[model samples]
Target: MTRTSQVVVIGGGQSGLAAGYHLRRLGLDFVILDAQTTAGGAWQHTWDSLHLFSPAAYSSLPGRLMPPQAGQEYPDAQHVVEYLADYEKRYELPIERPVRVLGVHRDGGLLRVETDSGPWRARAVISATGTWWRPFLPAVPGRGDFGGRQLHTVDYRSPKCFTGRRVIVVGGGNSGAQIAADLAHDPEVTWVTQRPPRYLDDEVDGRALFDAATARRRALDAGRTDTGGVASLGDIVAVPSVREARDRGLLKASPMFTRLVPGGVEWADGTRAVADAVIWCTGFRPALSHLAPLQLRGRRGRIATAGTRAADEPRLHLLGYGDWTGPASATLIGAGRPARDAAREIADVLA
Candidate 1:
């Protein structure tokens, strides 16, 4: 007989782990399937020097509070990872680590999840993995012809390697800003973007955005719906990054890439330049390729999840994903309510 779990939480990051903890707290039988060797999804992959802008207060998981801090500054990458690990241990969460999930589909009244390890059967599935897999690389003509090594911001780990190269970081998002700042340490670095970035307040406590998303979700839950969502910019809000970079003479605004020649880049301003390396910090898409055969709501890989999607398919909900044109669904702290809501739904399903 094939054993089944009440809920299968995918990915072991903040969302996934949070769901696991909540499920256990509600006395539900759930399993957390993580692809990485351990928790701390993006934090572990981020560069060594990267630090969160969100204060430690807002970054806490379900059971444990983040270590005391002097102020509202963000936590370092390692500290975030350590906190997550402690959460799993404190809650006694059952997480199957390094289990690479291929996809999830409905099969005979059960959510059949295919993974590298084996088949998993569950009543509901929570896709806690965020939108970080598909690095959004804008199509540039002859992009492959360039001689220099091309890598996305995801692959970047440190600036020591690019100590002498004229590195160019594309896109105006936080990743681009951080990468450009890292490259700024090298005098040979040049920053470029398609447009000037939108700068919000430097001290963007994600708690407010989280509350806004919760309110919008509650509004949708009620009969009166506005059909909108909210977003969070991690610990690195847009305003601080843009302002900090500008203060250091490191902000550039214009159409960045027009074409890629054999050994040079063609900018939209009709300027031709060659760089030793180009890091595309453009952004990422909802990484649902592994989740084949699921009826997603968008042409892109994203699942069209809203207030209803969460309620109806609580067992199989999407979190930390951009709402596209919607208000602000793509955020970290905003995921708390969804995580708890999904946990409650799964508990009911098991009952």
Candidate 2:
């Protein structure tokens, strides 16, 4: 086994797999490091009932086609995992699974990556480890005090779990909206958010959001970072899920309560809402502790993502950044642009 691979890609999820496949097609010697025992990244963490809003046709990696599912919506997380397994088998990419990367440090002109299983050296490193690293929940004053099994959207699995519970889902992003809609159908769910997302409707096609993402990427490539953000003015008019919640009266268009008191949460408007559970739909921040030495500049833990996909960190390349990656870079339909470009950039450095 060659200890020194020319390139090392960290992660085995969709983006990492895509990057690895692109490197293979480019004829670059590389290895993919994944922390999970499986290939799918967040898919493994997503709730069981989840299915991608995007259809299967556009979800394939650049070279591989998602096996056709004529009338089905995009495959669920398990299906994605199965597809990934097939992809790894079909491509024969060198992937070391369950290899938790502890630290990535430069040693003697080589990048040394220490993992739980072992160590590897490479000339280039691509952190394709998608953006779902950390689950963000705003610190409520008495969150622990009134706790009735609180969890982030990251830990949420199915509406069935909240079937008989008075659930309060927080946050206004895509995940929160979808989860709220799903839970609303259970007759025991009600949602409140601090700020309503200016969410775009999930049209039959997600092209608008995707295209906006592309434009945002262009701006980033041109050295812009503050251009794209909540597109709405405290209103979620575009999202199908959000709309459904509204239609069902399950969603309350109000800011989150000021604090989570001993028995319930206090809304901003001085209304007290009590519930058996509070689901923090709060967004996430990038957990890049492994890249501590990179000195990435950005508010919170989010690096100032810029360029083609903005997943291009100065010291690393991230593939599955959030919706900001643009139309062609955000979804399975468009993530290749960044992977290929990042591959070339890595190639240039390691050449």
Error of 1 at 196 (Å): 1.5
User: Clashes in candidate 1: how many?
Assistant: 7
Q: Which residues of candidate 1, in runs, are more than 4 Å off? A: 69-72, 211-244, 306-315, 323-331
Model 1 Cα RMSD, 1 decimal:
3.5
Worst 10 residues of 2 by lDDT: 229-238
Give all TM-scores, in the order shown.
Answer: 0.86, 0.86
**Cα misplacement distance, residue 237 of candidate 2 (Å):** 9.1
lDDT tens readout by residue for model 1, 76-128: 77888888788788888898889988888788778888888888899888887
Model 1 has an lDDT value of 0.70
Instruction: Find the candidate with the highest lDDT and give its number.
Output: 2
What C-alpha lDDT values do all the predictions have? 0.70, 0.70
